[model samples]
Target: MRSGARAVLALGANVGHRAQTLHAAVEALGATDGITVEAVSTIVETAPVGAVPDQPDFLNAVVLVRTDLDPHALLAAAHAVEAGLGLDRSTKVPDGPRPIDVDVIAVGDLGDDVVLDEDGLVLPHPRAHERDFVLGPWAELDPDAVLPGAYGGRVVDLLTRLHHGEGPA
Candidate 1:
């Protein structure tokens, strides 16, 4: 394994033991070979957002991890964790309800933000800077968190901007 690099993950679930599923995800990530669960933000319940909005509210939280795994490998682990906890993306509506959804918010150390664009993974999570579900919990977990990339800055500031209606559309 490589030396540990930091990564932020956002987890949400609106179906099947939402809180428990998020907790289990934290435990699972902690147990993964190359990942160490660092801190977890308080879970927040919020109305569903995105294409499919007529769904149950979602319980969302952020998990910070220090990992030796590369970005893609870490994402694979997240997907595996989601699958193990009952999320079947193949059968769900796009942006619809699911038992668990794990998203990579950002990857890199405290000051250095990594940028990547691939088929299924995009670092700094293209829209993380805009989603309160992601930003709120992230700000709570890491007070000094910085999101690197376009539309990126201090997490707190981003969240403030989002709340002030200053975020991207």
Candidate 2:
């Protein structure tokens, strides 16, 4: 059997039962073949980012998973989990509120600074370092987590810097 690669995922939901949607997404991910959820961060509620004004606040969390699937397959699995939870990206406005949102933030060490602009995927989630919703929960799950590449730094440090107005705008 091939060794599983470690990947980080960010999850959020602002519509319906937010908490339940997030939890269910995690569970669904674990149920997929070749994907094993290793660690999950505590859920945090935060105001929407990039949403239309007056949009509902979101329930957000981060998860670490081990998967034998390659990066592309892993991404597809993440999207599948989102779709299963009622996230219809095709019809939803970008950054809009949703039943569930699952993003592949990074994929192993290869994800460090590696830029891939495929049709529907991007690695290292270009703006992850700038978002408290992503970094905060990530730090909780892996204090030693480093973004790697040009955005190099520990997750906790990134979150601290972002909190203090030092991170990217």
Pairs of residues at least 3 apart in sequence or in different chains that clash in candidate 1: none
TM-score of 2: 0.93
lDDT of 2 at 156: 85
Best by TM-score: 2
lDDT of 1 by residue, 1-169 (tens): 5468889999999998999999999999999999999899999999998899889999999999999898889988999999899887678677899999999888884323355446478777877877999989999988898888766888999898888887653
lDDT of each: 0.87, 0.86
lDDT of 2 at 43: 96
Task: List model 2 lDDT by residue over 4-47, tens digit each.
Answer: 88899999999999999998999999999989999999999999
Q: Say which candidate scores most in lDDT.
A: 1
Per-model TM against the reference: 0.91, 0.93
Q: Which ten residues in a row have the lowest lDDT in candidate 2?
A: 111-120
